[model samples]
Target: MPYNTSYVPNYIKRQARMVLLLLVLFTGCTEVIELDIQEVEDGLVIYGRISNSNSANEVIISRTRGPETAPTPISGATVRVIDNNGLVRIFLEKEPGVYTMQPSDSPGDFGNSYRLEADVSGRIYRTDFQELMPIIAQDELRYEIGVERDITSSGANIENDVVRIFGDSKLPSDLPEDFFIRWEIEEVYSTLTAFLPVFWFPGAGGRGQCYIQNKLGADQIYLLDGRNIRRSDLNNRPIITRKIDNSFQNKHYFNLIQSSISEENHDYWEKVRTLTITNGSIFDPIVGKLQGNIKSSDPEEEVFGFFEVIGIDTTRLLMTNNDIPVFFVDPCLFLGDKVFPLLTVPFGCVQCLLDEKLIEPGCLSCSAITNSTSRPSYF
Candidate 1:
């Protein structure tokens, strides 16, 4: 996935924190109250990750829904990170509750320990100083076509082919045995417009096909526990699987990112993953709040969510339609105008290519699709 400098909401990421928000909403349960746990005054949820990649560091502060209030962003707070060396680096609020550090300032370093401090309304919330570990680069990413069985909504079993990706990683020799690893996968694909409707002249050639780039699966998380493994090299470890679809019909790139995280961070996410599976069943009992490392000065006030410091290494693998064992249908294929219900005319009817099917934006231009880019620089 492209490195984003701006603040993106936790809900938008669809990460583990989004599920934690559900706990904030169900705090009135008798089981949680019996546990002597009181909700944070504002239901504060502060989540952020600062990495060696300066451009991707960001902090998001928002309130979860309470008894009578809807969730909202927390604004006008002072957010900063301080290192063991006494260097205080302030993060500026780019949006309401999103803060990003000035990249030109002191970027994150691997050896140093850092602490996050947020001052809101004279109350201070902070996390214990967490040390950043050395980056662990991915050795390689491998993929193969495999068939998997799926059940339809009507309960009919069917088989579908999918692309399964695996990864290889060689752990650093000097690292402690207690270190943890996390893998994140992202997919970028390209598409082209089948045809262009508007023409300046009778002979005007079809507007050159617009090549659009799209991204997917950036929020999924995969974790690995490195403490027990005696071997240094991890080979052919299963990473992720994606269904073979139209996105594979073009230049598709799978980005595998590896990061070394603290054991505390790993445990927090592990709890989330466990809760997520149990949450699927309505019969399961609601889980109480999963406290994070963030702490507040007032004993009654509790802060939820984690602030993590990590170093990430990424590897990209490019695949095309030729990579798939079976033929994949092209979304842009021109079967017939009737297949596309919407139509429009882009120019004057005289010289304009006035096909009713052209009213569909994708038929006229690939740019009509969301997150579509005309040129892919990585090519």
Candidate 2:
């Protein structure tokens, strides 16, 4: 019997987010139109990542679905990782189509080559060996406030304040001049619930202080090459930016993770970003299948996605309302006495001073409005 890994819906959800972001950025100012996308038989979609940490490595396998359908997990597959040292570690499925490295397995080492192999329904699939690259540390993370203009759906121009984050790093002279890098960002912040109820109902949880963490989807592949630079150190390079909103209400932290990748991996992501940007354009080049390192023993089989071993470095920065000199009103307003008749009370009240009516769902629990409730230790 073949053991399988656990299914993590978030993994694919992130991929979907990446796709959506690319579409939004690439198709700016285009007229709203729909194209008939043809349906085809589902193919294999694999997403895997490996790093130099002790944490468990993961790979997600699912069958591609139609444009209107969600992907379904592929099960009963044997998965293994082999290093150039000839040592092989088998992965067990914790859930359908999700494979994870055993806790006892050793973490990937830098300067070593690793390959992945999967046997699904007697068909063998494998990836070309990828070498682990050296990690590069970020020297600094900086930001700037500016204005951005956009045309609304109704053809009106709207200008909004925006914040852009930038990063810098230095390349040591001893290292090779040719290199590839990838960037990712995550946000952590706290939210306040208006009221806390003293008496708890069976299913009603009191709301007070809640925190949430979200990983922002990066639309563009932030791949950089040392060969393109004349200096030994990379100057201020832009990472990402966002409009000042409720997320920056009290305090927030953004973490930027930088990964050094192989030239092949860099090219793969570059092609993906290009294809996404040029999709549906008359001047667009023929969109051929973007192939990955993964391959199948059967000549007729098709595979999608990449498996990578990367060297990573991270830097975190905190931002507060003070950072943005602009003054904005709180979007989440208090219901006040008007909500008493409707059974919707403010979040801070312990009990209804006047009536026994139930409070609003969101006022009762902060988690109800956000995906996470636990505050991060660093925050």
Candidate 3:
């Protein structure tokens, strides 16, 4: 079975106790899950999500076993919101699987990075991400960008090369933790036939967290889905592009220019780095077409390492990378509405829009918190 019917939590202070239990059940086992559980257990199969002020296309957290789902639509598990500084939150379970924290003094702080914390019994496990600020503008209303790329030998095909978007404006620090990048572009195919703009995403797109970059083994995920054709070895697998040889369509290549938002996280708020990829650049083998709408969006960004400290001031941001583009800088790249929503089980996460307020580097939401009160570096 690919899922489990129940979960159990045991309190064993010694390592020996853990080893013994694992030895009894680990040789080989498989299980799959179905709708609501027939029973409940202390060790809950948690469910939650992350979302933003944008429209309704929400994705959820899922294992490698299948496609993405909306936030598992949860309500009972304990929810913890941890700032990069280690300041932790023990959210109150307001409903069955819904957890709530008192509305903050203002909105979430942008300059500061945050993560999540979940506890079951005495065990505390952490996701690769944290709570974060909303990446948008406050004062100056609106923003836009144009993207185009040259083709390379890589399987990536440089197709639609332009992208644009409108937003209030952006501050060096307003970038959110779940950076959900969106690229609104002209439809590639005919509307009557091609109803939607060919949107590209990482690991798992729209459906859930699968499209999130770094969410899973980027290139390797193709194997899990059985989407590629193999040679002798799995490493030698081949991709299956949409149009082959003579089937290539020129009209299909040019995406109509329209309102759009492509993403490439410009800063190190989350302690990660993106490539020099432009709008039409192809990324990994599994991910083909570099449509005019490039999506650098995902709920959890990879935090390869860290800096001066978590939850610090703008001063903490010193141009850390030398090998980059001048257009690239601290938290400059993101969508007007959201980056990505946190994947909370059955239901994806949700984030509200920026409260048309003034944006100053040091000011996040209305309650600007600084490292004056430091925290742990759990991320």
Candidate 4:
């Protein structure tokens, strides 16, 4: 045996082969888990154009890509553009989901970063950076709200509370007169899976009939005491405010509880509502009344409302980092040496994007402007 160590026995060799075969059979199998991406875009397609002074520049955002549709037609979307600083530079709603805007000043420039955001079904999405030489500023807008009449289903009459947008800017007389305008109202209830879409009256002459869609007929819209627009009409001159000393105080449902744990200083985030109503486009048949138990009125339970462009939040991403930087959607400002990536942080609850990573938004340094005085001195 010592002289023929290399010459192993056939029986020993057979055992070695069997051991190797057994190991391969037991440990050499594996499988991969793949991700399932749902095809989206069945919702309304709201896309639009933004006209700027700096030549023509297109706004594209992947996050804002609407859900999946059968035969998706890209046309007719109401497009809105956010400037380098996170401001709603351009916002116009088309028939479906198309928004269009002209350069309030000039076309977007290169090197400047801009973010594109959209609101659909009460959920909002923002796009990645569209680097341009410079992002132009769309004429700023001043928004207000008004109150009008809201008829009921079974015959209960109620007043309607409406949002009025009074922007001070130059109106183009060349562009065809206000032919028609359509807007989409997105409503989401905690108990429902589908968001309620309320498409309302066609407006002309920069005004028309529009109301909250999908109301339970009985829900009456409320008009806050003093909300009206400037007009020459006798009855509609100043939006008439009908006071309701009854249980349904429109201000009752305005107190929205906000957690101070993480927040930003934005005028829009301020809990109080400071909107004035316009005369021409007053609320006629508004839906959904401010309904709540007035017993021991708590500001937390009041049903708050929307005012205008408060801020832009980015889509949540699953990445190595947790704190996503917040950036102003200003297209004019380019990345300086001190600036990090043009940031947009996501809001609301989000599951892990991709896999094995987490992305969430951080508190911003800007302060939210509160309209405490705007709400009537009455509680």
lDDT of 1 by residue, 1-379 (tens): 3333222442321122232311110111111111223333457777787777756577777775543343467799999999899998888888877888876666678898989999977889999999988765446889988999989999999998899987777766665667777665666677655432234223334544454433233323356666656566777766677888877777888876667789998787666421222112111111225577889878798677778887777688999888888777655554466333322333334223335433346545566665554454565
Better candidate by lDDT, 1 or 4? 1
Q: Clashes per prediction?
A: 2, 11, 62, 82
lDDT value, residue 263 of candidate 1 = 90
TM-score of each: 0.73, 0.73, 0.24, 0.20
- Estimate, for each residue in 1-379, the C-alpha lDDT of model 4 and write its tens digit: 0000000000000010100000110122222222222222222222122222322223221111222212222333334566677555664432222233444634443345555555443344444444332111112223234566767898888875443322121223333211111111111111101111112111101211111111111111111110121221112112112222211211122111111110111211122111111111111110112111111123342221111211111111011111112222322122353122222212221221112122111111011111111221112
lDDT of 4 at 169: 19
Model 1 RMSD vs true structure: 8.0
> Model 2 over residues 197-264: C-alpha lDDT tens digits?
23322233434666766555433445565555545576676667778877777778777667778988
Give the distance in Å from residue 337's predicted Cα in candidate 4 to where it truly belongs.
76
Runs off by more than 4 Å, candidate 4: 1-79, 102-105, 133-379
Model 1: residues with Cα > 4 Å off, grouped in runs: 1-7, 10-41, 67-70, 151-157, 173-175, 193-195, 200-221, 273-288, 326-330, 333-379
Error of 2 at 316 (Å): 1.1
Worst 10 residues of 1 by lDDT: 24-33
Error of 2 at 92 (Å): 3.9
Q: How many backbone clashes does candidate 1 have?
A: 2
Decreasing TM-score order of the candidates? 2, 1, 3, 4
- Every candidate's lDDT: 0.62, 0.61, 0.23, 0.23
lDDT of 4 at 345: 18
